[model samples]
Target: MNQPTHPAGGDVQPQDPPAAYPPYQPPAMPPRPCGIKTWQIVSITIAGAVVAIVVIIIGVIALSGSMNRVAKEAKDYYDSKAEPYTNPAERKTYTNDTISFGYPSSLQEMSLEGWNYTVRKGTVSDRRVFGDKDMNYFVVYTQIKDDGHPAGMSKLQMKSEMSSLFDQAQSSGSGLTDVLRHEQLICQKHESNDFSDLTASTGEIADGTPVVSFHYVCDSRVENEDSKIETYQSTWYDHKGRLNTITVSANAKAKNKYGRDSINIPGLTARLR
Candidate 1:
């Protein structure tokens, strides 16, 4: 080893050369297992969504089938219950000068004077011929003389007139309030029919004379108490040019027993001469 001389010194100690070093390298990481690919994850998600959709569709189909079955069963039950009403042996004929019809023998003929609303000034005759055992249901037959009112009025005309009467009665403090719903309906005289199958429709009878129907619901003071009444009125002109009106009234409690849907308007009208 040679000694190096300093600028101001005679001899300097021998110096070691710069140390050599290896290139820099990062630390090694542990080996890892393969992870799921993005495509595989997406595919799995799509497959799950498809399965869910299929399940929902199947459930919907099953529910629809169940609902249909329940509806059919209900219809069959109602039809079976109404069989007696359709049988003539279970009913009695009620004939008067204005109209005639068959009513269930379970009901009895009642006095018209008890029905306060049926006593109109223009009415020629009024008869509350049939009522349920509890007096909750009433069928009134009425004839209106063509004094100033037009004969053979249309369904719309009848609806308007009846609505006016309702408004008047309410305004006059007749205890008729809250006219909830009112609508014109069709009246058909079927040759042979099932009461359960009869529903309120809007059209004219093809073979027989057309009849107008109106359905209304209101709150009235009956027997010194407030009550909800549902009334269905069917009107037509007789051969003598008088307006014949058949009114069916059902109180709230009686609705369950004699619902508007259960009344066979066509059957009753068919019995009218």
Candidate 2:
């Protein structure tokens, strides 16, 4: 039988239903290898950092302790080498017409030969010398007439006098050379005789005395010997209208048994009239 046609249109064939799609599924992933978890990794990193910090702290503590020990050992070594001040009672008194002072009994009376002096005199009146057995170190205490120099001279005057004296020594072929140090020293009485407590002068000394100090090196003058002699001197005018000088001479090759640059000026002045 012939099919009926629609008006002004050709017959349309039936379309198949839309093909069905499989349910959406993602590609399968490979299995993971057995390993530490994220939290475990974090814990291990923190533990390593803590251990490093602990090691640093221990190293610092050990270094600090070593430094402290070294410092203490240095101090102890110097302390042992230092000579203590002689007790007043145990000290021996040296008395002369012009001056009287206390000296360590360990020192014996010495001669004035080869001693260097800043204030030269035709003859040292009322002089006393004391020194060690080897004479490597000695102290000369001498007094001279004021020669018109005023007592308690100013620092300028003292310096001028020192220059003049050094000039004289140089002129006289005394072999003094190389003025290593020259200055005014302000000294005060201390409860102990330790000279390490000496302080620099702040223009004036409160209840203290001022003295001029000098240091120079001289030829040993020994036959065929190339050694030098080191000399330290201190000069001050006392109220007695006299010039007092204390000289310390040391052999360049010998150690400083007194462990001081100069004698205790303040202590000696206290005992001087």
- Report the number of the highest-lDDT candidate: 1
Worst 10 residues of 2 by lDDT: 181-190
lDDT of 1 by residue, 131-216 (tens): 66455656666666754566555546645555554454334333222111111111111111201122232333322444655555
TM-score of structure candidate 2: 0.39
Top-TM-score candidate index: 1
Clash numbers, per candidate = 0, 0
lDDT of 2: 0.51
In the range 96-207, model 2's lDDT, one tens digit per residue, is: 5434556556567866665454434333445667765545555567677746776555556654665565554444332322222111111111111212212221121222
What does candidate 2 score in Cα RMSD to the true structure?
A: 18.5
